[model samples]
Target: MSPLNMFSRLKNRKSSATASQHGSLPPIDKPMPSQCVSSPPVLPAATMHVKQSLQPAAVMQPKPATAAAPKPGSTDTVRSVVVHAKKLGSGAYGAVHLGTCYSTDGSVHCVAVKVISAERMRLESLSREASILKRLSRAGHPSAVRFYGWFSPGSKKVSTDATGPELTNLEVSHCLVMDRLSGGELFEYVLARKGLSEREAAPFLRQIAEGLAHAHSLGVAHRDLKLENVLISASPSGDDICKVCDFGLAYRYEVDGSGKVLKGRPLTETCGSKSYAAPEVLEGRGYDGFDADVWSCGICLFAMLAGFFPLDEATGADWRFERVKLATQHRQSATRTIFSFYDRPCQLSSQVVDMIDGMILVQPNRRLKTEDVLQSMWVIDDTIKADYADEYMYDEAPRYRGQAGSFDPNAVSGYGGQQDMAPLYRGAPAGVIAAPPPLMKQLAVLGQ
Candidate 1:
């Protein structure tokens, strides 16, 4: 069976735990060959319990356009752009449509237009996500999605969906323009490739770390860090890299509490998909958002490398989840812990499992940071080796100072260097988290 089928069985037919439910878009014309991400090398997974080589890629075929046909009579214009009936996806934030943009320079550009109706959705949440995207775009973080800009579309009518009138002629309160990614969500990409090898997944993993780290450094925690939110983009060099998208639940954060810096202000609202949510968040006990993000990243990694979910839902009721918890708690250390795994005995390398253990721990305090993940052998290689000690995320423009000095680097880098710095809280001044206890001798601290 393909990974798609395998994954469904793994989920036991439960809808994927998404913070937002995204509707499938009407398929657009496939882009030129240059835009396609070259398929990864298919490595043998005969040693593993499940099939790694999923043959015959699964493509999302657009249904026949059943909605009212686009007519010349319909004034489906938002600003200068023409909104087509083709929808990419829709959620609480707004409805997104494929559009033709007429630029001031006379250049015709294809773009994704997000239409937000004040009556239909909360303007506050939409504004928050938009602002965060704008900031990340201005920073030009390669892994975060590019934002063109947003504007209030005064009384402009836009189509919500092709199928229904209730959604049609939506008076747009505001609209957002963004790059129309030729490649779709990473969820669809994985389904096409079946599953990625450790080799194929490492580059993507590092890119995700880059995006996540940059967001954390900027004081944004992507509460929803699932496969669905990541999109594949073809590089100028023609290689495919994953981009993190969807900041609908992003936490701007609070960083004043001493313990808050390492984790985050205890998040009152439990967010994120059930399968990917951190145990602390699920329990709603003032959990940190940053730590919760790390847990979700582990779930993303497990799907790519193992080609299946490690568990259905990350709660005690599920036997798979219980087993993973048992392994983490009972095992003497990250290295020694072994998972019986869900539905099969796991055959992944010990190092990858250890990395997962570090991130997926039930306790938020001990969950590994993004830096800790970058340090994993399965994730790091020569390509990303420079990132091992680099604090590029926190560095301001034209300045490179991640090296050693009298000061601790994490504090100096503004939370970019360490796994746990306060969020809503910027990173501490160098080595603050790593520093020894104040007023205690080193020997005394070691029980001397």
Candidate 2:
């Protein structure tokens, strides 16, 4: 399909987990092209289980555009940049849009604009996310998304068009401009095309492991690291590499119980997608963000291989509690169930299931850390070199041809900018429910 058509398809079916909702088929086990060794490979499943399980119940929904678009007045000195905007996806935060920015410099850029209305902004709030993105940017972490800048009220931009009292101006109320991810998301990619075979998924898994390891080293927890947040971007040499995005729920580990830091206080809130959330988080129990993120990654890896969630949520609250309790109580049983569920398992040189076994242990303490997981031996392959297809094609800047950097690296501190954002609550960080002691120990072991 043409890229544009695929883009439209993504928009139309994006709301439903429509990509992989159909019954499963045998896992595709094709070896990745020689050039894209860096890309992850897919694992073959012995038997495919098609029943849908715990898909993201909460898809991001955009807030109703203000009662009316922002009013344009003489004071509104809108730059009127010709930005073609289309909604990409939505979450608790708001709607993410794909936009083409036409600049006076004659440079046309494709950017992702996140639109959050005042109400939604206050509810889900991007403050913490913005802070997390900024922290990652300052650290130059390859795994985290790079922040460009934001276009919100009081910015240079005024309006997009001159129309009926300028009323339906679709006022770009504080849009976040980010590098457009042309490759889309890894989740959708795998769903459209069967996930890479075990051999194929390794390199991609390695990159993710390396990225997670690096992030953990810097004391940051991505909190959310599903296929959706992973992006494929072109390098200067035209090769695609994965870069993690979406830091709305990231937690800075080094920061004290309070949000204050040498740089600035970070925004804190108990937020995360339900399916990928660690057991502790869902139970309203306090857990280390870093450890929880690793657990989520483990769930992702299990789903990737098994084609469904390893553990299912029981129907009622009481049943649900019992399910989690049972799953946590007997880690070995849970792991065995997952192993047996996959009919066509990847032919492994070693005990591959052990790795997943360690990752999703009911006890958070026993779960693996980002670094330890990367070193787990299943994800790494020294010989593999991935040749991912070029997706986001960018024009090369002429060398020694009077070319200048189009965007200022630090011109605008997208999220780091100081604001009088009030603290939602003050105390021992609400919802700081401690993890079960056994779970905490398990997490510590996994981290070690």
User: TM-score per candidate, in order?
Assistant: 0.62, 0.57
Query: Candidate 1, residues 1-448: lDDT per residue as tens digits?
Result: 2111212222332322111111222222432222111111111111111111121235321121122322211223333666667788775545677876655566676778777676755655556777777767778878877776565555333323346553464454566677787788887766455456566677888888889988887767888788878888788999888889877677664334352433323555556665567777666556667788998898788766544455445665444454445444444322222222111223444445556666777777767788767665556543322221122212321111222222243442442233322211111232222211111000000000
* Number of clashing residue pairs, candidate 2: 39
Query: Distance (Å) between predicted and true CA of 236, model 1?
Result: 1.9
What's the lDDT for all of these models?
A: 0.53, 0.44
Off by over 4 Å in 2: 1-82, 101-108, 158-172, 236-239, 253-270, 313-336, 339-351, 382-448
Instruction: Return the top candidate by lDDT.
Output: 1
Superposition error at 441 for model 1 (Å): 53
